[model samples]
Target: MTAMRHYWLATAAKTGAVLADLPGLSVPKVKKVIGRYEPATASFPLVGKGVPVDWERILIEGATVFHLLRDNPNDPAHGIPVWGGMLVRPPRTEADDVQLSLQTAEWYFDGRYVGDKKYTGVGQNLIVKDLVESFAAAGPNGGLPIRVEIVNGGDGKPRDREYQNSDDKTLYSVLQELMGVIDGPEWTIGWEWQANPERITPVLYVGDRIGTAKPAWMPSPAAVFEMPGSVLSFTDDRSYGRGKGANVVMAKSSGQGGARPESTPMVAVDDLRPTFEYRFTPSTSIKDVGTLDEHAQAKLQILKDGSPTLEMVALADRGPLLDVDWFIGDDIGYSIGKSSRSRRQPAAIQVDPEGYAPASPVDGEGYGSMAGLTLDTDNYAEPAPDTRPIVPAYPRGREGVARVIGWELEPQGTPTVTPILYAPE
Candidate 1:
């Protein structure tokens, strides 16, 4: 049979399999000699001493163009038995080549539409649709082989060059035709228009792990409004002494303040307030397949068992503010606190004079009213002369002051360490 005939037969067989919800017979397996058949070695062993056998779950769901036919037992042809098989072709890759084939097919058919309008026609819409669908079906990491070749136009080589030069024009015409029949915005087509070649690389996949790729196909919002809910607010309030007949009055102001009266006793005040909140929709429908890290290979093992699951958390920032929320959780509020320099106390020392005697010749002793110490006035002055003159000063005792600058609390049983800053002295 001719190649065309064989192709049609294969297409029909595939269609029949789809309609019957059955797996196509494995041609490779059937071609092998039954007695000589040997199972391939497993790259990794499943159990100690045996090779692992892998089986793919047959996909019985797809578009089918044919239905099963029942044969009459009384007919001689029916009694002889009828067998059917489908011809399976490898997937197509190479966007440019696939696009060229589609264009050539349209030109050869004289504008006859073969596939879905949303898929085929102008702008290589059909070709792109096919490529996307194939890519998706093959898994994110799978690659498709696409081909592009120059085709002869009846006008000759020069005509082919013209076609190449005006490829966008041909695409535009096809888009117009498709748009006339379909409902949507006009399809846009261009090359290297806004794409960054360095980052335009395709997503890689090894087994089930899909490599990183920017989702450029996603649609952008018509207009992005800054939502009020996205903003986080914080307030600080402190009051000292009772309201009625209180001798002390405390007033706190932020930003700008008015002049104070001369008779009014005043005290400096400082306060700090900071706010943080996450603003994200809560839903499981949105899946965020995180970037592949060092554990990508190990994670693939889980996907082979079943469909991979994922959760996405939306995050946004405006100026100094940030908002984040989980897509699959109830609305909740969270708080974060910050320290201010003015709120912290300065370093101080506590001294005592309980052992000092006024009549003693000791000179470093002094007596005065202080928070924690009294100085002895009788011995406040330096000694006139010491029986043993002080030995040559050894590097004039270096004076230093050490104070607590910061502190942090690590949650009980946690390995993490956190720092708490202190106001500078």
Candidate 2:
């Protein structure tokens, strides 16, 4: 059934004055809502150096996977804080409510590497090629290559020793630990076709390869408010609960670069839970020096460029602006039937497993599209040299459909239309 309801599942600094009406932000009574039961998710990562706020719980309660975007739309001396993530169409709920359980568009693989299961040699960054390979085994469209744009994101560095993880983690969660040094201090990651496996043309914001925009099938939003109720519903699924934050944790290197090459895997650190201590390094000399708060590291990753600090995390940009496409473009017909999808129109009938009991037209979407054949199939299918087009006339009515009543054709001659009838819809 077509969904008549919508919502945005988002999170923010609970103490912030900006996103006051938060948690379950309601979708305006606008017509341009996303089609189907799709989940919309937003998040604020808790990163960088500072006093730790218990944000690990937030990571679990919110979107399962997220893209850490550095947005300063209003690039002022003080930067605006913005973090973006991914969402998919949720399955039908048992009740009338919607579920916003968001999984990252990127998938992860877990296995034994060096030590126990926790020290699963898997690092923050999994090869895109390998990821698509493993994911394709699940389904047909699942293997399709989705263009994942990792703009301005820092490389995931492997530390000097073997590490252990309580659980596997997503690459996004891993890179969110370090601030961007390549495109720094801000950039955005936008992707499509996660729900619909069809490939979406990529957009080039600045490069010479900039092409025209793609036709967006989903309804665009009108306005985005910072009021509450954005995160309207939550799932009680404990599997993806606090313990299900990131899938893989990066294990330490078996040996250092030179002199102190260890014979066995070096145990760098222990498992990270809702709260874990860390020691980050650009180089040994530039290490965090003391124990670091995992939450604080996330807060710093999202802090404005030069304004990256723990205190600023509380006042960071609290939104995605939540606006839809600026304007809807005209429809450009796409191929169906014989050309695209490599399938032909069926000559057989289709029946719904559930008996056809259509709701009122007001409720809409009561039937699937139907196709029919003419009585004189040869004239329409493979017209003879003298075949001509014909139009049947009947009493004018507000609504009616023409149906074949009979056909006229000799055993050796071309078929022709004989009688036609019109009936009200």
Best by lDDT: 2
User: RMSD (Cα, Å) of candidate 1?
Assistant: 32.2
Question: Model 2, 251: alpha-carbon shift in Å?
Answer: 16
Candidates in order have lDDT scores of 0.20, 0.23
Model 1 per-residue lDDT at 360: 15
Which digits, one per residue and each the tens of the lDDT, describe model 1 over residues 1-425? 11100001111111112222222212111111100111111011123432212211111112111111112334422211111211212223543111100111112112122222222123333342333334322333432221221111111111000122222223323323322221211221111101232111111111110111113453321111111222232221122212211222222212223532111222122121122111111111112222111112222222212221111111122211111111101122211221131111212223444432321122211221233334444433332353221212211111111111111111112111111111111
Span of ten consecutive residues with least summed lDDT in model 2: 308-317
